[model samples]
Target: MAAGTYQNWRDVADLAMDAIAKDPDAWGDAGAGKNCRSRLIYLYNRRTGQLVRTQIVIQLSAHQSGKSNRIITAYPRGHQC
Candidate 1:
């Protein structure tokens, strides 16, 4: 996936982790599937230099034994929730 305004994959991961850590309740149904989850977070856009609503999606590995959860995608969704 394209990093877009993000510096790199690590940058996106760090922001997503921080958001989840700060407010666990922010995550909700992503509707991608049973194992997928999504969260809307306000994050700093390095290009815009503004705080924007970003969407972070993660897929749980519940169906895959011994696998870990992984982020599926992250992007700026503007002000929409």
Candidate 2:
């Protein structure tokens, strides 16, 4: 993996913080204190040359059934998805 790649678990945790700071509403019921896992998604827009980094969090539930998972989302400097 490349340096600063989001594929790793630690990077995901670090990016989650940035996501929290970028958009708190996407956090849903899971606040920063809650146990969560995140994935980093990159986007490109016509208006800008740089790519936008987005963080998506999967809300951990105790009674989650198979395929029935809870997820929370957060984005940085762009429209909420």
Best by lDDT: 1
Estimate TM-scores for all models.
Answer: 0.41, 0.28
lDDT of 1 by residue, 1-81 (tens): 224556676777666655654554434444444233335655566787776545654423232343335554444433222
Clash count, one per candidate? 0, 0
Model 2 C-alpha lDDT per residue in residues 19-59, reported as the tens digit of each score: 54454443233343343333344433335545544444433
Task: Estimate the lDDT of model 2.
Answer: 0.40
CA lDDT of every candidate: 0.48, 0.40
Q: Whole-model lDDT for model 1 versus the true structure?
A: 0.48
Deviating ranges (above 4 Å) for candidate 1: 26-38, 50-53, 59-81
**Model 1 TM-score?**
0.41
Q: In model 1, what are the clashing residue pairs, if there are any?
A: none
Worst 10 residues of 1 by lDDT: 59-68
